[model samples]
Target: MTGSITIALDAMGGDDGPRTVIGGAAIALHRRPDMRFVMFGEEAAVRPLLDAHPEVDKASTFHHCDITVRMDDKPSQALRRGRRHSSMWKAIEAVKTGEADVCVSAGNTGALMAMAKVCLHTLADIDRPAIAAIWPTMRGESVVLDVGATIGADSKLLVDFAVMGGAMVRALYGIERPTVGLLNIGVEEVKGLEEVRAAGRMMREHDMKSIDYRGFVEGDDVGRGTVDVVVTEGFSGNIALKMAEGTARQIGEYLRSAMRRTWMSRLGYLLARSAFEHLREKMDPSNSNGGIFLGLNGIVIKSHGGTDADGFASAVELGYDMVRSSLLQKIVNDLNRFHTSDVPAVPAEQ
Candidate 1:
């Protein structure tokens, strides 16, 4: 677990299938040569691409399966049709069976999540699982959870997300005591839903040593990096994530339009080309490619289906980092401490 990590890859997942998936694996291999991959897909497509990159081929263990879970397929449809035969299912099965340290897929989010929950199951004392995204912030990065995993979360679930997201931050950022915040419309305790307020009170009262609870953080604080972990129910988290992405894209478009509007602006852009490039790199969604599913017994990383090799590589690297940092163990230990610290299992409504 400490050394070279083995990754279970859904090679046939994603928009481009094996080409993009294997290409990404190749890119990851260049960065982490010690890493090994267990690929699941049809040999006809995967082998040739693996041959293109001898290094990945040498380090890979291929499991051929003709079936693929379609991108448009619903979770229930995928479960019924692509159960044991699909590449995605097999990849997740590797993690469940202890053959791989983590499972990575750039496939259908709903299907991957469904399969993962079925195969790995939830960790002990955990009810619902959450999807945590590494959000880029002004200070650096913060972990935000329940980003479209489920619609709504109870107060207890929100508290669980905080603990889970805090573990993610610790694992990825190497912070011993990361700050946690409940996402609210306002910083005032009375501004949000009772669930949010209750969750915040529990996090504050519990005095969990692993996380530095920073109380409520507004949506703007997400970009400002007000906390290391942003806890929210899935509905609002997903909306906020999408809104941020849209705003970034809109800003990029505006920058381009403004630069092209005048020769003087173009000259200025040329003078600051390097700075602009750095900003673009920072804003690129590809750099932050993985949405981690937390509270599961095993690690499952979901990459954007349309991302290229470099983007996929970022997701793979994230999985490797999580395995190296022993994220699951950290979450489990934190959960044990949280349950034993005399914190009420159910927070009283305000």
Candidate 2:
């Protein structure tokens, strides 16, 4: 529609096969008629879906890829052997070859990450690519990094994560100088290990002056949206992210069911329905679709495992935004900003 913004989708990647993936692609195309998608999966699976819908026939095309990547497969296996047979692998390769601007999948995250890293590589100065999870804040949406990218890292890595993540919040959302926070057990400087403390100090006294390092914030500050970028180790960050999602879902469901229990409650629900819908959508991870694996040379986004058609649709939308935003160029530019020669030695905050 808009010339050609071809998205190579791994139809076999997620829990739902071609059906959900194809349906989601349709939804995305409908939302933006200018975009076209290439469904890469078994031809048998993709053909029927196309034959049934004229919109899909005219607007989208399917590229046959026979193999599907399993959730439990190893990363290397996904690249070498998976490529030999898997559609997801081929879909990723499509991006590398300029066949597609972005690739979307609801498959195994580790395998996807592995294949992407091997093929796309990481940006210079970026150690481990961090998974940036965009969350709802009182101030709007904020992004938390290493949501499951790296397990353990050094202080400098954390600092770099902060830089890339701050850039992400600014690029995706419009936070000019996003506030950065270190996720630690305590708020005091002396509370965390030397690595955490050192990173915090560097951020506080940072010379780049581009980042807004807000001393320290504990886990509770996450949902409240106190900071624009919350940086943490991958293990800790991932757990915190999952817990927050689970809590939001449970609370939303509980409230919805409770409101339907009585006639007066139902009436009240109708009166305050907009508020409930707003809160529910805000808390819904599926609405966010997929998250970008930052610091990578090419665009790589991961959709949740049990995501529905709507969820898959969100991933596609994010992929489009990633391309339009020129995130790869942004990451490279941000990293180059604090390079060895020209950077001013930002003083550590006292």
Write the residue-wise lDDT of candidate 2 on 1-350 in tens digits. 13567777888888877777877877887886777776678888878887876686686666776677787788876776775457887777778888888888888998988877877778888778888887877767778988887898778888889888887777787667778998999887668767778787766655654578887889999988899999998999999988987887788789878988999999998999899788777767788878778877677778887888888888888888767666666667777875553543434546
TM-score for each model = 0.97, 0.89
The numbered model that scores best in lDDT is 1
Q: Distance (Å) between predicted and true CA of 151, model 2?
A: 0.4
**lDDT, candidate 1, 233-288, per-residue tens:** 99999999999999999999999999999999999999999999999999999999
lDDT of 1 at 197: 87
Name model 2 segments beyond 4 Å from true.
Answer: 1-4, 260-267, 270-275, 341-350
Candidate 1 RMSD to the correct structure: 1.3
Local distance difference test values of all predictions, in order? 0.92, 0.79
List pairs with backbone clashes in candidate 1: none
Report the CA-based lDDT of candidate 1 relative to the real structure.
0.92
lDDT at 249 for candidate 2?
75
Indicate the worst ten consecutive residues by lDDT in candidate 2.
340-349
